[model samples]
Target: MRIEGKTFLVTGGASGLGAATVEALVGKGAVVVVADRNSDAGAALRQRYGSAIEFIQADVTSEDSIVKALDLAVGLSGTFSGVVSCAGVAPAERIFGRNGIHGLQSFRAAVDVNLVGTFNVLRVAADRLIKRDRTGGEEENGVIINTASVAAYDGQIGQVAYAASKGGVVALTLPAARELARHSIRVVTIAPGIMETPMLLAMPDEVRASLAATVPFPSRLGKPQEFASLVCHVIENPYLNGEVIRLDGAIRMAAK
Candidate 1:
């Protein structure tokens, strides 16, 4: 469970929470594989962290890319002890629109990225871990932390597509964990509320403040470091499996 001398794969490692997790792992003496769609961002991360990090350009929705990513993680460093699936898209749309129209393609795309994309990383990573060698550690052969959103449970009006995709992720956690238990790999999810990631950081200050104000306690956005810290804790603590931990601060979203 110790990160020292272990390896980890972080999908969507180019930016946002993924980037923060990568940095955190690296700081703890772990070698990291940064798999992301943006080659430039990956390159920049590599440059920032030097040789401790490896990167592969991959699309989470494609099986071929997932294969390449897993292979690269092993080939470039070695078998990974953990995987963090943070690759997701948050596209907003309603099932029926104001004009009585809906874009099916857009809805499907949201599902593809947020739902199916996460599963692609999960299944493939578990397969590789099942076949790889493990160090001596109780209930700690490997770990997978998936990213979900509070929207899955409390979706606002305009977030139908985004919410549905995230909901599927939340739904899959327990079953996935139960099935993978025998293999010594643990599965868990984190449903974050309002985080000051790039997506929200790009919004105006007033808009961001309004979003943070929705949180009843602390009344502010969650920090990416807080999420990363919990991930580290989950990895160290062996019994925290098959649970979806919400990182939202007492904030249950309302219908917008």
Candidate 2:
């Protein structure tokens, strides 16, 4: 569980929470395979972290790509201690509406990445983890960390599609934990509140302020590193399993 001297395979490691986790783990001496579709960012990360990190371009939505990334991970790291699934997308929609409602395609795309893609990573990584020998007889072999969203619980009016996909992720944690328990590998999810990602960061100052004001206290968007910290904690805590931890401060979104 100690991040130091271990290898972690992280999807979406080019940016946001994924990038932050890679930074934290690599900083602590953990070797990493930063798998992401964004080759530019992934390559830059490799440059920044040097030997401790290597970038792999893989689209999480494709099974073939996932397999490739997993192979690359094994090729570089020798063994993996953890798999962090941070690849996801949010597409807002309504199930039904006067203006023809949201497109089903949009909804399906969200589910494909946020939910199904997560499964691909988990299934692939857990398969390897189960077969691999435990480093120490007293503890688990590996960990799988998933990303959900606050919208799963408190979705806004236009977030039906996004919420459903995230809800699937939330629902998946328990079942995965149970299934993967025998191998001593833990499965967990983090449902984050609004974070200052590139999109949010691009908003006008007053608009961003308005969004921050919605939080109950410490009115500010969550930081990617804060979410990464929770991941680091879960990695080291053996007892934490089959749970979805909310990284939101105190704020719950109002129905928009």
Candidate whose lDDT is highest: 1
Give me the candidate number with maximum TM-score. Answer: 1
TM-score of each: 0.96, 0.96
* Model 2 ranges off by over 4 Å: 96-99
Q: What Cα-based lDDT does every candidate model obtain?
A: 0.90, 0.88
Deviation in Å, model 1, residue 182 alpha carbon: 0.6
Model 2 Cα lDDT, one tens digit per residue, 142-197: 99999999999999998988898999999999999998998888999999998988
Model 2 root mean square deviation, Cα atoms: 1.4
